[model samples]
Target: MTPEELTRPWPPPTPKPAERGAPPTPVPSAVPRRRLLRWAAVGAILVLLVWSVQGTGVSVGALIDGREGGLHLVRGFLHPDLSAAFLADVGSAVLQTVQISLTGLLLAAPLGLAGALLIAGNVGAPGWLRGSARAGAAFLRGVPDLLWALLFVATIGPGPAAGALAIAVHGAGLLAKLGAEQLEAIDPAPVEAVRLTGTGRAATAVLAIIPQARAGLASLLLYQWECNLRTSTVIGFVGAGGIGQELAISLRLFRYDELSTLILAVLAMILLVDQLSRVIRRRMGAAT
Candidate 1:
């Protein structure tokens, strides 16, 4: 070997293809100040929540006390009096409650649909008209069912009519909100297609939107029906007719036996309605 070749320095190895034109990847840093602040805030909130709950006397002891009281009360309800007059009165009261809920729900459906249509952007009427409808629905919804029942009781005198009207008002508002949501979520393409066929807005809604929204609408209606049943029981508090008045009277008299009977009856009614609603909902799902 020549002395010049022996003196030459060795060359460094070539870089990989991936590393040739690539920029240096930045290294990940530690958690930022914002993240630390967030964790601190969360810890502070948890501390405040625990303190507030304890300060307000909302403790495990309160729950235990409530459970004990309920158990004691339930003991008296174990035996029920089966007098003929009492049974008849209960039957009549239950029938009255059913009538109130059904009548109210029926009256509410059309009004709620109209309100929903007016509030929905795709099928709303004139701007001011739509605004009025939405305002009416909001007003009705904001008022509690009990308040409406009391108001109707004052106006119409204590009876089933008052109770029915109260349920109608609240039910209409709730149904309107749900129905409007359903209407808004409907397929707009169908609506446009119907319009292209020279159909009017009302006609387009009837043909296009209603068909698609019918399932949700029906479900909402059944849900309202279930709710109204529960509401009807309480409307009797204002003397607007139902089993609730009798239950209240029995409680006032400390007739725990009779009260138990009423409670059981109400429980049965609720379970029945729930089962019926479930069946109908399933059928609706199948149809769709």
Candidate 2:
């Protein structure tokens, strides 16, 4: 290279295709396409939201008009019925709700564990078995607890038994699905190490997989129990028997004060269950 050319610039710019007498490269449209796609997605989401609002009949004016009635209800809730007779009934209903939730969870735990074992990938279950288990769990979960309660109510007559059975079935499905995911997500090293010992499948799973997944499984079960408790109260509204039945009665009679008391009782029960679950989970974690 000439010294003059080297002194002109340390690095010279390449000539453009147009200057080289070649057809100018077409500017890529990718950026514009991407921008269009993003705008399209935003528009689609906005359309969906508007459609949902219209279909659901959401109205700011209706909410404003109901302010007085809402205040009346709030006042009733503030001054909840605390009469001795009513309190006694509330206590009984609360006990029944607790019993129903306990019964449901007890019945669900074993069934859920079995289903979890079948569906869990690390367990080496056959594909067909896993698929079948998944299908069964889906069926159980697809039917709402309220519908299950109605079915049981029709078959066994309305009572806490129906509610318990409903909760059991639904809780089993929930636990099975969650437990399977938990099992799948556990540390694979322990499982692999156990298998290397030439242990049988069941032995390896019990020793390695179960131990690793125990805390998660326990947490899932406890959470399901809390869910069952809520479901128990709801099922009672269908005459399946629990605090929900009392709630239904109060609503039918327009006894807002009693309804408020029942609501408070439900809230207290939920808070108690939540706290108990947290403590149990903490202890389990510590023990592990």
User: Cα RMSDs of all predictions?
Assistant: 5.3, 4.0
Instruction: Quote the RMSD, in angstroms, for model 2.
Output: 4.0
> Tens digit of lDDT per residue, candidate 1, span 43-63?
999999999988898877788
TM-scores, in order shown?
Answer: 0.81, 0.91
The local distance difference test score of each candidate is 0.89, 0.92
Scored by lDDT, model 1 comes in at 0.89
Highest lDDT scorer: 2
In model 2, pairs of residues that clash are: none
The parts of candidate 2 lying over 4 Å away from their true place are: 1-16
Q: Give the per-residue lDDT digits (tens) of candidate 2, residues 1-288.
A: 888887897578889878899897688779889999999999999999999999998899989999998888888888999999999999999999999999999999999999999999899988998899999998998899999999999999999999999999988898889999999999999999989989887897799999899889988989998998889989999998999999999989878899999999999999999999999999998999
User: What is the clash count for each candidate, in the order shown?
Assistant: 0, 0
TM-score of candidate 2 on Cα atoms, chains taken together: 0.91
Candidate 1: residue 269 lDDT (0-100) = 88
